[model samples]
Target: MMSNPEKTDLKNLTLPMLERFLQGRGKERFRATQIFKWIYQHDAGSFGEMTNISKDLRTELAETARISKLEPEAVEQGSDGTRKYLFSLGDGNAVESVLIPIEGRNTVCISSQAGCAMGCEFCLTGTFKLVRNLTTAEIVNQIMAIRCDVRAAGEEIRNIVLMGMGEPLHNLDNVIPAIQIMIDGNGLQLSNRRVTVSTCGLVPEMERLGRELPNVNLAVSLNATTDELRDRIMPVNRKYPLKELLRACREFPLPGRRKVTFEYVMMGGINDSLEDAKRLLRLTSDIPGKINLIPFNEHEGCGFRAPTQAAIDAFHTFLIDRNVTVITRDSRGADISAACGQLKGNLENRKEII
Candidate 1:
């Protein structure tokens, strides 16, 4: 459905917020739960599709509200079955989400903002810089829109990672509520373990995420082993240095069998040395988290090359031999530019040249 700025986007509201809206309209609070179930669980696109609700109420709701869904401006599929979607945000901006199907599980990597402000030296999105933070409806609609496609393909989105276009913690105001709806049993019904929020070391907001949504898995993008290196790569490190970031990580409350995940992108000739691995072991020894070494996904003009297989294997072996938990993540959708911000950047460049 088309966006209507004059009407309330019901997807923007959490359960309580929706309940209050209904109550203020002289309707029963239970109606909010019903509407939520229809919207989230049943995939109701229009208020009229919510047949269980009274026709009169549905008419009233439709006038004041709209159930907005993002229709992808374009979709690209990789040979490995990973699909990247470009969704227009209706204000001359767009964001992307990647759907990865691996070994019977589907994971959707969702964006929290239209473009990134993090300015990581290796990232493509950083070149474009920040456009704006996505609203709650925008974030939730990524899941809703993709889930429809997943269902059609006879699969389901089993996991979600906030590791796409933007830093999740930077937009916690909208991200947290979108997360709350995701884990809400009556809504998305995803277990807290299934939803992962990846941050580029936003320490203070990371602490708030732990305190507020302690059960959801947290993944920190700890790409560098030293502050000198990290400060050069991830700009956020300059503000919340390694010592303070690790302190907050150590304090983060993880639930049973859930350790924080440290995602280290191995950049060839950059942060992929055995020395860096040894330093990484020392850095993460105390924190209850495992290392996920991602060989950097190379892109045009980024100036950073993907780590050699030898470098990746060496890093994994060192961490494993030292009794540190670690795994090498397979780079998915490379043919489709599935790496964060690649597709969006390419589209924008094409438009410029056109």
Candidate 2:
């Protein structure tokens, strides 16, 4: 049987906080940095591996602080080099994160909530009820686990997308701190430019994110072109309509050459019409933006199918013809139910609390 006591997840604690904790325990400040470096930079899984620290200090840390690790219950790899990991948290609550390797960059999709509250009609995650927002440590552990895997494979993760399970803006308190930890040079060391936070048009949080975290990339999941359609598809739109959301995007204070990425998932015969494409072009005309046209990735209970290649191509061309910079995102890990909005976690199916 495991003899571990309930302790703070050290992987979730920031470097400075760790230092303070050590200082409180009458340990030298440098010991904190060393432990931090070992856990984060060297990927030490246990305090016993922190060799530089004295044996007594190591024992103290072992008893006082806990290093969080994800026990991957299941891992599925797609033919297109996308991998999905179903990680079981300490409380048996499970969450899913994916790693997609494209060209030279690997983008890890991180989840902020166990299940999404945003009831976007076509989303697989939205089909399930929101369980609870993930803690900052839980969110950061997903990235750390993937980073460890990348190192073992002699590769590096170049980007991160908060586009996996939940609406990020809804969990801004935890999400914001998690991003800060990722961007911290002493930790994950990911650049803000490479971390994209995707939202379903949470207007107040959108504006606040722009003002507070200026460097992180922002992406709005704008599935429909008009308010009527948007409201029907995304219930959040009923509160923060298209006009207000777009206005927030336009007024977003982005730095040099950093344009907000607008994610448009194409649903076959639903929002894939040329008229919808034109309206999309018009809606985003004045903002500095790039459109990511994602062909819908279907799930078991979700009744939506991806748009045809021809229809997707038409939508891409329509945006580019109007001088809009567009890229059709290749849906990865779809076969394993790990594509966008498809991560509902195994815990849900098991009827377990997450």
Candidate 3:
């Protein structure tokens, strides 16, 4: 008989670790690679799918380990090919992840925390309040689930962005392991250049990440130019001011030809002025970086409005004229509340299931 879903806690173990455990039990070590491929490359959700393993071994696996624990509770698909997946964690708490399909690349946005502690005024997740940080297994499960979905659609994923739900740096313990698992060449095999970690300026963590994981791209959510404005919009700035935050960036090691991304969300009359653009250019001038100007995505209770198109264009031009590299991020999934700050899983009317 198949064991109860709760019988195994294998979600936390890497393929090599699982193999070691099986070897300790007198099983052949090679079974580990077969099972690992099944879980990651082939999207095997249960031990029953590992047909090559003996039924006794499968039974042992069923009793000893769980391949995945998260269950998608709801899915919201936007008209622009963006899909928001809301997953129910083991404790019944929920979080959201987004899959965006661009011209030639498919990017999955994975969350690190259930809700956010960084009280960014315009973020919906922040409004709901912090719940808890997600486990490393739960974080890896999100990617595996998305990869399964992509394979079913006859497509392949090309990139990953750690820009969903919560501040990654704040949950470094789990986030670091999750990132390593995602980049493991024998597993997900995604190149470090293709992975980006976005933070709300957690200085110490940022510095640590630079020294510890220098390969992954770094993105700082620098919404404002001044400490006064930043402190108002992002409460974390109170602990690590703009000066200190920039200093950390300056000291961060960057790979050749790879530049750190500075994410600036444009809210009308808030941080979208030409003057703000100039200040941004000055702040990032010393560091090799590119600016991703995001148009604010709105929700019902959120008071911010996206900057006018003309204003956004002018801001882009201001940066370009100053010889700063910039790109106005194309907004996707706005209609389904899957864009930038639109992911709030509190909606009582969603009908799609995982």
Q: Evaluated with lDDT, which candidate comes out highest? A: 1
In terms of TM-score, the best-performing candidate is 1
Task: Please identify which of the two predictions, 2 or 3, would achieve the higher lDDT against the true structure.
Answer: 2
The residue pairs in collision within model 1 are none
Residue pairs with backbone overlap in model 2:
none
Candidate 3: residue pairs that collide: 10-66
User: Candidate 1 on 90-193: residue-level lDDT in tens?
Assistant: 77787888999988799999999877888888888777788889999999999989998999989788999988888899899999999999998778988889
Model 3 lowest lDDT segment of ten: 345-354
Candidate 2 lDDT (Cα, 0 to 1): 0.85
**Cα lDDT for residue 160, candidate 1:** 93
lDDT (0 to 1) per candidate: 0.87, 0.85, 0.84
Task: Report each candidate's C-alpha RMSD, comma-separated, in the order given.
Answer: 1.8, 2.7, 2.7
C-alpha lDDT of residue 23 in model 1: 96
Q: For model 3, what is the C-alpha lDDT against the true structure?
A: 0.84
Which candidate, 2 or 3, would have the higher TM-score against the true structure? Answer: 2
Sequence-dependent TM-score of model 1? 0.96
Backbone Cα, N, C clashes tallied per candidate: 0, 0, 1
User: Tens digits of per-residue lDDT for model 3 on 139-239?
Assistant: 88888777778888888888999999889998988888777777877677788899999999999999889887899999999999999999999999999
